[model samples]
Target chain A: MLLVILELVGIAVFAASGALAAVRARLDVFGVTVLALATALGGGVIRDVLLGVHPPTSLTKWPYLLVPALTGLLVFSFHPQVARLRRAVQLLDAIGLGLFVTGGTSTALALGAPPYTACLIGMTTGIGGGAMRDVLLREIPLVLRREIYAVAALLGCLVVAGGSVLGLPEGPVALAGSALVVAVRLLALWRRWNAPVAHGLDA
Target chain B: MLLVILELVGIAVFAASGALAAVRARLDVFGVTVLALATALGGGVIRDVLLGVHPPTSLTKWPYLLVPALTGLLVFSFHPQVARLRRAVQLLDAIGLGLFVTGGTSTALALGAPPYTACLIGMTTGIGGGAMRDVLLREIPLVLRREIYAVAALLGCLVVAGGSVLGLPEGPVALAGSALVVAVRLLALWRRWNAPVAHGLDA
Candidate 1:
């Protein structure tokens, strides 16, 4: 039940981000909805596909589709109000990132993927949606450029995978992993920490 | 045997297009190679995943990885010369588009997907890689913009799916479908045909 709630919250936050991106790009209503759906579900879909699950749960489940669609509609109707709370939204997004990373890692581990692949898939699950959103908006993905985004997810995945490898209990390990992600992400935001940019012509 | 050759040719053409896009974006060698790999195998990987195939063949198979990598390297070293033959590249790309559309649709049908779903998947397989390449380069996908790109793929898919619905022989139907796509795509290029763009507010 708690996991379900976490996933829903994560979907809502990601959907909000996607809607904001569409608004910023001045996209039409159809585009806004498409972006919202992609941002909220794209990562999970990608992960599921990588794991060989056909007809991704997101596609088959009604709530997964409804939540993002409604979120997009709400944002479209009151974007000005939403835009003013950008900081709050980013914080929520960070929380969502934490939840998604843990969920993804646990799921991959349960599916018997190698620790390394699990870690990578976990990180991808956290960042893939936003990357898809940016791509649709014709912009460089923020995760790939600025902030300690992908790195934070990676660290979270590493912790979770390491704990699992050590035979730690799943619940506690997942909690610890999520906490790590949230802490690192909030700290990076507060401190304006960024990943290093590639330097020189060969990078 | 024929299918293998067709797939290889498609990969090479798509990889070339990806390398050219990376070059146009002023990306370094790493970006070029990444784009090449994404464009060459992304669509098939996506299709496989949708069909519940785990660890996509492209990811596991050595040749799939090697062919695109080599193509990327070649393009990176001689992009200027390749760019000069833009017309030839487009011709090859059109052929690749046809082959991929037919292959994807047939594969989906064989997997027992609904005809509509098969058609959609086929179009996705034909266009998905290019779309990903454009997105990575921070550009609107060419398939989504100018030219009859997606439409050509859709038409090809329709023919393939339609034949299956009519209980026709797979080989002849697939061949005819591919021929239709190639003809339409090349005609569109020669005639400078384009899909209509929204002419209103906030496109």
Candidate 2:
């Protein structure tokens, strides 16, 4: 029950990012809604698909679909106000990243994937929605280019996976893992830390 | 049996496009290979996932992974020569588009998806790889921006779906659908046909 609430909150934050992007692109309402849905659900959908869950929860569950759809419309109408709240959204986004990575890792673990694969899948689930949104908006994925996003997700996923391997309690471990991700992500953003580019590529 | 052969050929063609794009982007050998694999296998993997097939054939089957990896290496080594063969690649790409849509539709139908959902899946399967490639390359997908790509795929998918509805034989209908996609794609290229953009968004 708590996890579901976290997931919904994460979806709404992710959807806001997507909706704002679409608005900046001046997309029509339909396009904004579509992009919002894709950004909010793409990661979970990808994770579920990898786990062989048919008609993924995002597709079948009403709340999973509804939150993003409604959020998109709200953002579309009040984009200026929403844009002014960027800092708040970013904080929420960090929390969402933590939730998604930990949630995704444990879900994959429970669904029978090995630890390594679960870690990879969990990382993908944490990053996939933003990647899809960037693709739709015609930008190279920020995660692939500059952000510490995937690494942060991986760290959290590893914590979750390690807990399972050591037969530790899942709940405490998950909370710890989520905290690790949130801390790492917020620190990275505050410090403006970024991954390095390949050396001498254009030199 | 023939379908498998056709699928392999289609994957190779799609991989080539991805490799060429990666080469143009001046990505490293590993990056080129990664993009090729994503482009070649993304659609089928997505289809399989939606159908509840765990460890999608793209992941489980060595040959499926091998073809694109090898193709990427080959292109990376001889990109100039490969670039000169653009026309040939375009022709093969049309064929690939045909095979993917028809095959994707039938596979979904066989997997018990309703026809409407199957048609959407099939069209997605046909266009998904190219869309992914463009995203990785940091460009608007040609299919979304200027090409008649998705419509061509949809036409083929609808034929497959309609054939099933009308009680026509699968094999012949699939053949006809593939031919239709190929013909439409080639013709659109020759004629410089394009879909209209939304009116006066920035005008």
Off by over 4 Å in 1: A1-45, A52-109, A113-123, A126-130, A136-138, A142-203, B49-57, B60-62, B195-203
Candidate 1, pairs of clashing residues: none
**Tens digits of lDDT, candidate 2, B1-203:** 98888999999999999988876776656567667878998899878876777756665566787888899778777777787898899899999999999999999999889899999999888888988888788887888875688889999999999999999999999999999999999999899998887798997
Kindly provide the TM-score of model 2 when superposed on the true structure, using C-alpha atoms: 0.62
Using TM-score, give the best candidate's number: 2
- Write down the TM-score for model 1: 0.61
State the weakest 10-residue window (summed lDDT) of model 1 chain B.
Answer: B25-34
Could you tell me the interface RMSD of model 2? 4.8
lDDT (tens digit, per residue) of candidate 2 on A1-203: 88789889999999999999999999999999999999999999888878877778889889998999999999999999999998888888888888889999999899888787687678778988988898888876666544477667879999999999999999999989989998888888889876533233333
What lDDT would candidate 2 get against the real structure? Answer: 0.86
- Candidate 2 stretches with Cα past 4 Å from truth are A201-203, B1-44, B50-52, B57-131, B138-203
